[model samples]
Target: MYNSIKEIVTAANETGKTIAELTIEQECQLSGKSRDEIWQRMTVNLQTMQAAVQRGESGRGVFSQTHLTGGEAVKIKNYRASHHPLSGDVMMAAVQGAIATNEVNAAMGVVCATPTAGSSGTLPGILFMLKERLSLTKKQMIDFLFTAGGVGLVIANHAGIAGATGGCQAEVGSASAMGAAAAVEAANGTPEQSAQAMSIAISNLLGLVCDPIAGLVEIPCVKRNAIGAGNALIAADMALAGCTSKIPTDECIMAMDKVGRGLPASLRETGIGGLAGTPTGQAIKARIFGNEV
Candidate 1:
């Protein structure tokens, strides 16, 4: 039911329903559960996301033996508290949230796998930031999750949302797209604008590789989530300003699939390529794993 962006938007437009409403209706029909049940389930996910964000913000990111990435989020947080961050409050907040969530994941903390664990940081990062900035209620935040879920459903159905299957373009890219759509909806944008935001997000990060150093979801992964959050915010802003993507959302997803298929095996979640293959990356891996790379 409504696996394509076009279908989702059309249904939303025709029924005078938001994307979240359409998605909730679909979930109820498919699971034979009441709307309340679905809402309760998503609330659990929202709480989990919130907890991870809290842990991350408190600087609990260093979980690996190497201790490479845990303190960056905390550093950013500290810097923001004292200095005027060049990116402003909302962006700084998004960056901290994204880093904190990914830090939690890297440190083996609990996190909601929005589409997947590797890309979990984007949605919550943007949502929590916007929640405070826009004075959004808990119900409005849940609606944001549902709107994001709807975008992710279409992407997963059409292309794929895993790094091994479709590279980081699928992971962070899809998550950014989901975050963008959700941001638009949370700001009272039309479903069509949400679709446009999703497209802009996907297009912005196309062809990104999943080359985590040592095959660990640290290193560039956490920072990439930060960038993904930024992309989502800017894309949402663009959509709200009436900017439209030239390629349609569904077609953009198709292109993502084609690019994913064409990516070299070494680039697709294999630590043997990209950043993981660099001299510094290999040196870090050797240091961490005690292996001669």
Candidate 2:
């Protein structure tokens, strides 16, 4: 039997675990300890990446950016000036780096089928960025993660997480929903508000598709994460303010599933439609594949 979004969130609260951790625990219970073991390995991988970043050893691939803080106007100017040439703020940069460069650092084990490697940066990135801003303790961070996990598990059970299977709703949509729920929890929103945030996220990203270029997760994938993160913030705020969507979270997830199912194969992760069909995408493919297709 499929678990509803509310049910999942309730379970998460009861277990005192994040959605990701709960997912691992459930996997372990059903499939042995393999998933849990893999999660531990991924944790080590993330630590190594963070260390490399601290050492300035890893080159910023697609969207690398210099860190900045302070005066709003100055920060705005800096953001605009450094926006070009890509920066670390872009979700695509991280995702592309993860997939094309095999430089994953962990968030939800997107390298596996459940999450795409390219879209893997959003959840972890948002959480890390929040932690940096709030100076949250490790325990707090874990708690936030557990809250987010409950929302994610609901989406997985009600909708999906595979772009190939559910288009961008599964990829960016799910990520945004997870981020929104996480943000709400981090902000101390009630469980009901967290679920509302997820609903808002799904409603906003209803028909998004998976259209990577040259079969690569770059292009729209990375930029989409930044947008998704922003959306998550918006949704969380709205939910926290006591705004409720006409459609419930579970209904929204179901709608997303229906929309994804209706998408043509070309728009589905086959890299045959949307931005993937653009001239730039074709040229990149030519350069990379040498007309092999």
Candidate 3:
């Protein structure tokens, strides 16, 4: 519904409405759904996210058929439980939570793609981790999803959120930005701060390529969501602390489009460059698909 970050932020400030409210209202107008209907839909999304996270951080964890990604989320949880993590509870919980969602996705389990299935872990991973710490109610968490949706809409309009189109910078990178903006509103930060957070988060992962080993989402894709979650949390805290991005959000979005367009096809989810080109990567692909390599 919003064309640019500038337009969304300025309007939110002037109208004295939260980004969540603005986005929900717009969705109502666009979809002809009542406010309650829209709210209910987002509630279902949040619930689905919760279910995936719960499954991931719990016993054994769901493993992918490829046998590449499984139980890593529980391992992280157990590690945090037994030892004092250098990253602390919030950060490690986010890491575990993010890996859980992607692990489930890789296993062909259900997951609500925040923007894309490959990048589903970032938002819920960060959101649920912060929920208890922030004492956010169910409604507030739902509002956070709406805020994330609003931020994502802006980025999607100006650029792309698909790895095939814009690489991981557009997928995980945009998801990180969306999480940062939504986290800002959840923490009671301003629209300007949300813009700053969004910019900071996206720029952190700028030029990140999609280089899945074995052409599967099991390798770096799952762990990348962990990184995205951390980036979003840091960006949100920085914005709340009055930190600013040297680049504006709208300009950053445009630059992302340009950078993604300039990247070679080998780096754009083709799995023929970066890590995928390594001997080990090739061997794994060969093992999976036969001696095609």
Candidate 4:
């Protein structure tokens, strides 16, 4: 029912409710399902996300068929366990969680795509990090997902969440923006702050192309999720620190949409441009498909 970020915030303020609560209410109306039903469904998604993160951090991650992305999450986890990461534990943990989720995705493992499978890592990265840092209960974690959903809905409506239609900016960018706003709400920031977090997150990665090397969601896609998690954290922190986005979230999303559209067709998940166009990229494609590409 919420068409824009501002509208959702206004509704939340007027009703003295959370963006998560409003999102649940709207889903009830749109899907004609009871609140309990919707909550149960979301609970499953939350559980799935948690499971994927845990699997990735298990020190023996699953590898994709192409062996392109696999155990990097475990490597991150181990590295942080033994060494002082320059980015600190929180950021590294987010990176670990984000990479783990996407690695699992590349392996064809189950994951709850916040908006899309190609960009599944961002929300869980921040959400789980907050879960441990803030000691979030299961219900609270689910609320975080709903808050993310509210922001993602606005972006999907105005711009899109498909890499094919809007490039990696729409997939990873929107997911990161969703995570930023949701992280803000989970940290008890105001709805307006959540909107600001979303704006900053979207603008930070606008026009990111969706060039999966060798047409696989490995190479850059998996690493991009790690960066998306970092972006979400930075944006959320900025909003919580009383920072405001000069461009409203709705405008930021629109701007992202225009930029994604302006990108050449080669950049929009076609797997034939960007890194995919490089000589090494061509060699990988040839190795994978044997002249088929």
Residue 197 of model 3, lDDT score: 98
TM-score of each: 0.97, 0.73, 0.98, 0.98
lDDT (10s digit) by residue, model 4, range 1-293: 78898899999899999999999999999999999999999999998998999998885887899997899898888889899999999899999999999999999999998899989998899988999999999999999999999779889999999888899999999999999999999999999999999999999999999998888999799999988999999999999999998998999999999998999989999998999899999899899989966
Summarize candidate 2's per-residue lDDT along 230-276 as a digit string, tens digits: 67777888999999988878889889888988999888899888888
Tens digits of lDDT, candidate 1, 132-215: 899999999999999999879889988999898899999999999999999999999999999999999999999999898988
In order, candidate lDDTs are: 0.90, 0.63, 0.92, 0.92
Residue 42, candidate 2: Cα error in Å is: 8.1
lDDT of 3 by residue, 1-293 (tens): 68898989999989999999999989999999899988888888988999999988777889998898889999998999899999888899888889999999999999998899999999999998889789899989999999999889989988999998899999999999999999999999999999999999989999999999888998789999999999999999999999999899999999999999999999999988888889999888998988764
Compared with the true structure, the alpha-carbon lDDT of candidate 1 equals 0.90
**Given candidate 4, what's the lDDT at residue 92?**
93
lDDT score for candidate 3 against the true structure: 0.92
TM-score of 4: 0.98
How much is 28 displaced in model 4, in angstroms? 1.1
Q: Look at candidate 4 and tell me the lDDT of residue 175.
A: 92
Better of 2 and 4 by TM-score: 4
